[model samples]
Target chain A: MSWGPLALSLQVALAATALATALGVVLAGVLARARFPGSDLLDALVTAPLVLPPTVLGYALLQVVGRESVLGRAWESLTGSSLVFSRSAAVLAATVAALPLVVRSARAAMEAVDPALLGAAATLGASPPRVFLTVTLPLSRAGVLAGVTLGFARALGEFGVTLMLAGNIPGLTQTGALAIYDAVQANRDAEALGLAAVMAAVGVAAVYVGTKLGRRRVHGA
Target chain B: MAREGGALAVRVRVAGPTAERPRVDVDVSFGVGLTAVMGPSGAGKTSLLLAIAGLVRPLAGRITLGGSVLFDGSGSWVPPHRRRMALVFQHLALFPHLTAWQNVAYGVPRRSDGRDRAREWLARTRVAHVAERLPSTLSGGEAQRVALARALAAEPGALLLDEPFSSLDGRLRLALGDELKDLVEALQIPAVLVTHHLEDAQRLAARVVELEAGRLRSERPEGA
Candidate 1:
């Protein structure tokens, strides 16, 4: 019945959602507007995590940031702590797992904007930044919010990657999902059910809000 | 008033997307008045306006506004935002997310009185009553005036309009066209209005240019 795991999970999900939302909006904007060679390939790479097994993604992340790797060594030298099995590692795992939701939703929203509107803005003497800020971004508000909420929900439910990268360290890297797994294995059915129910409630609420926003977008359009 | 200069000169060739169509060439000059570009659908009238607006690049051409070079074939090109050109789209592409006043005020310098200036333009266009409404809530005529107000707020060196009266009925078209022509004349800036309607062309323009299959067919000056 410890609250530590739930608090840590919320922290990881929130941080990961923030990172994913920022990167997703930028990448989505670029992907939506850019016309160049290898753009398709880059898009596929960003989305690969969505289709790839979480364990495989976790394993790949481990290879790059594990304690024996160069990046891990550099991190240890700088921060005097190993990269793997840390709370930051959990955040990274959740971010990678949740990024596709944000990118897909945000890109769809950005692409839905009429090119004619952009042309009108330009003709009105609006610079590129002005057009994006005043026209493009504001028009795509619903989609962006939907993407952010979906990413948060996805990050909250991430288990396989969290286990592989951050491990199940009590009062540390162990998030809601990991704690649930531990509770079930230790035959603590009551604690497992409590955590699982709370996780499901938050996840469902996020999805419900996201769906409502998406519906509102359709009605507005 | 616009700076003193000869007719805005344009001599350009646009390579069509397909080889079968080859190119659409335009050789015309527009003076400080409203000139109507009339043609049937798919005749590239809109393309010509877009080219002048810097939204579409011509294969080879020079566009000079007043004495300033807007574009030339020697890799000299100005991005659309810097071209000092305003376009009122056929569909009236007012920013749906913004109120009529905000849409008109969008390109104004970020100063305290920018909104006041926008309201002035809206009042001039006679859409001040709808200034607080979003484009979606405005009627067709109201939307048209709002779009015009937004364009005029830019104080563009040139104006390009794509079928501004297309969405309205015959009577409404003529009424709106006449009002639009008066606005253009009062501003004394070079303008190109693209339309497929001969009536609109004859009514709104002092000079009418015809395009057929992507080439300029004729230019006739209406009697004063």
Candidate 2:
């Protein structure tokens, strides 16, 4: 029956989606364009979260951001902010859940761009950065946009990682999914059903948009 | 004009997959105007331009543009953007995300006060109408013009093309070929165009260099 928990989840999902997309684009560019000895390994490493269970990722996050680990200590020292058990932790969890979606889409977009166009840009005297920004990025935009939408939707549905890592703090860490869980446990049937219906509608819209964009890509080919 | 330097010189040796295999070896001097480079499949005509553009490295060779060394053995290679050489790829690799003008803009300096010049370049190439559309929306011939316009925007010391008119229909190919020939000469930069089609070679080039099995066997004028 807590509207506050629902709002927290919504904020986490939205913020997580935005953060994941920013990292995803840069990761996709490096994966697709940069050739290094461990490039493929790096790609696999980034996508590792997709196959990992959320609980396991939560456990890993607990270790890395527990205020005891070196990285966690350094972060706390630098910013005086504890990410663990906070809304930021929820965002991080959602980002981990959604990252694969964005990176996959971005990689496909980068690949769809014709290499010849890249070549022409290079020959036209554009530097590597210029060519990628002006030609490569613009060409594979549909894929990148599609990927971002899907990542956001996926983040909205993330459960285990957000619950464990952020501890479902009422009105802060509780996302829409967690709010539904909370309502179900407390026997608040009407509020649970309402939130479920809204979530279902959002889910349907996301699927519909993703499917339409996918079809356009197939036809455009 | 390239006349002051005599010709654009390249000695390209490309090693792919291994250091043991004999790389694609080519040494040639191209004159002031258009020179058609005809070769069989896998003959490495495209490889030559890639080396000049700094897209590929020659195990041992040198490329000099307008009497300035662009590449030499042992890591004396210039970056592609600074080489002052523009290339039109056989695939007509126009930027799909950008409108035609934007693609052309990529070739020139970012702060180039040359908006009018870019517009005029599109007009001259007869693609001014499509200037607002992305490359994906363009027909094959239209994409080719955008590629050429982007190259022209750079105004490089040498112009290299890999199958400039390969994908177009006959009429379009011939028309674009004529226009490109006229334009490259007007600019007076040394140019090298590659093709398997003798017709494309003859129509656009005054002299021809034939490559077979990674070697330049002969050079001849059109039809004799």
Best by lDDT: 1
* Clash pairs, model 1 backbone: none
Candidate 2 lands at a TM-score of 0.90
Return the clash pairs for model 2, or none.
Answer: A9-A175, A116-B93, A117-B93
Model 1, B86-182: lDDT tens per residue? 8999998988888899889986655466699899989988889998888889889999999998888888887889988778887767777888888
TM-score of chain A of 2: 0.92
Task: Please provide TM-scores, in order, for all candidate models, with all chains considered together.
Answer: 0.94, 0.90
**Candidate 2 local Cα displacement, residue A96, angstroms:** 1.2
Off by over 4 Å in 2: A218-221, B1-6, B16-23, B126-143, B168-178, B199-204, B221-223
| Best candidate (score: TM-score) | 1
Query: Candidate 2, residues A23-131: lDDT per residue as tens digits?
Result: 9988898788889999988888788888988889989988988889897888789878877888888899999888888999889888877676677777777788877
List the candidate 1 regions with Cα displacement exceeding 4 Å.
A68-78, A218-220, B1-6
How does model 1 score by TM-score? 0.94
**C-alpha lDDT values of all predictions:** 0.87, 0.81
DockQ of each: 0.62, 0.43
